[model samples]
Target chain A: MGITKTQIFNEEQNDLAQFFKVLGHPARVAILQYVSNQNACICNDLVEEIGLAQATISQHLKELKSIGLLNGEIEGKKMCYCINVERWETIQNQLNNFFNKTKSNCC
Target chain B: MGITKTQIFNEEQNDLAQFFKVLGHPARVAILQYVSNQNACICNDLVEEIGLAQATISQHLKELKSIGLLNGEIEGKKMCYCINVERWETIQNQLNNFFNKTKSNCC
Candidate 1:
């Protein structure tokens, strides 16, 4: 949603929606997967691995970083990126709790 | 993407995108959280719980169910909805794998 429509939602709802919205792109997912598989901080290999332009990958990286899912540190002219383990665990726990609730009294 | 732009993306990417896209809405998130917090299948209480109209809640429910995240069972004039545990686990695993990759050589 744009700015106005989002005002109707509570803070938590908006935060959760913003998190999911950032994941709505496949390129982002692929980028996250690529980073996750590496098992170490990465620097500038997305263009070759993802078959996307440097600018596109950079944009996706920016989005992930904005959400605190991917952490980055500047080294020379390049930026090194890795998953934020604590944030990842928090997200995992939040989502797991949501899914773990079983149906006790369905319709 | 509407129709044509989606073609540029692979099948797995598109499927994952679809799943995240369905979750991009705050109303949907609220509904999911509500359902999860209930710990049971719920039918027709969304209007009261979510403060939305019946049509709006129904539309959101349909979107969630369409993505296979929520399962519904018919009972009389109502529909009882609960989380699809198997699919939820699959989604969790897929996302976990994506996040588990450590950055090997980021830019």
Candidate 2:
């Protein structure tokens, strides 16, 4: 968790928690959904869509990118951002594995 | 996004965010795992298993319970906790719906 006690748990648990941590904010969820629904990646559109300032939107985008949940490129004068499909699926699998592993018949 | 903007996002996104927020901690993840793998339930075992103090483990357990991912019962002197199957299935479906909604082809 901190510096010395990180090794007790395996990598998968840590990675899954990180993904969830990045997704803990509503703004990030809105950003991801807006990007996912668009035919093309929307950069500036998010500022308007989420009703947040440009800087706040950029901060959320950066957090999403930190988890590899998104990718962006400079398109003409602006940057276009979209979901990282491979990473999304990777996270999907990770979450699926975690949820599916629970037998849950005990209580 | 703040006091005036809570209505901007729908209910599902908010609920999803809450779940992610609770699961953001590795200690909580470990606690859930330890509870899930047992046949009955483990309350005090977690203190030893996680190697954390009693108060620390209780705090994590409270967070997990608040999210409805766990259920506990007062069994004599100690309490026994286990995964809430119906709620687990509910959250599993929620995560699945969120993930499966993404078309994710055009990155």
Candidate 3:
């Protein structure tokens, strides 16, 4: 893959693309949906809930957390995870802004 | 990379992920923005406008078109490109639905 010329784009474009890139994988999307659907923080349930291996789930969770979309904590032997609500809202608004501002004008 | 377990995910999850994956690249996002900002179809200008090589720009355009976000046609010598308005609206709604339905309940 060619190196991305991220420097050529503004902050909003780069930031928005990063968010979308992290969410590009189905495992990450499924993980986000599962965690967000829960009433409280979840621990060690993702492997069973998403039907992926523990390491695989951890990798997906790591990707989501890298973007600050998921908040996680270590509780003894288990690591608990939940949505980072503020970050979620911020990303939602960012996406909305991109879509709203870039309304197409041509055929 | 492990093969994505697409079968484990529902249609919505797979569809949304594909959209996000295509938009994940900054070059693609820039291409879409440039095309949408234009009042008419753009042709041969993307290489200059996006500061990418002709081949690189074409690849990115292909990815955008693969997701149905871009409409393109050959205008004699130059290939004209524009946003697919219907597909854009549908994707916007899909993103909004995913965000709305998966409202975070914790942390």
Compute the TM-score of each model's chain A versus the native chain A and list the values: 0.83, 0.86, 0.90
Kindly list the per-residue Cα lDDT of model 3 for residues B16-85, writing each as its tens digit: 9999999998888788788778776856688888788898888888899999888889888888888888
Best by lDDT: 3
TM-score of 3: 0.94
Q: Return the lDDT, model 2, position B101.
A: 85
| Residue A38 lDDT, candidate 2, scale 0-100 | 84
DockQ winner, 2 or 3? 3
lDDT of each: 0.73, 0.80, 0.84
Best by DockQ: 3
Which order, best to worst by lDDT?
Answer: 3, 2, 1
Q: Model 2, residue B105: what's the lDDT?
A: 41
Global lDDT of model 1: 0.73
Which docking class does model 3 fall in? medium
Residue-level lDDT tens digits of model 1 in A1-107:
23325666798778767777888888887777777767456557888877777987888899999988888988788777887778877776655554455322333
lDDT of 3 by residue, A44-70 (tens): 688887898888888888899999988
DockQ, per model, reads 0.44, 0.56, 0.76
Between candidates 2 and 3, which one is better according to TM-score?
3
Tens digit of per-residue lDDT, candidate 2, span A1-107: 44425566678778778888888877788778778888866457788778877988888889988988888888888988878888888888888888878545475
Identify the runs in model 3 with alpha carbons over 4 angstroms from their true place: none
TM-score of chain B of each: 0.85, 0.86, 0.92
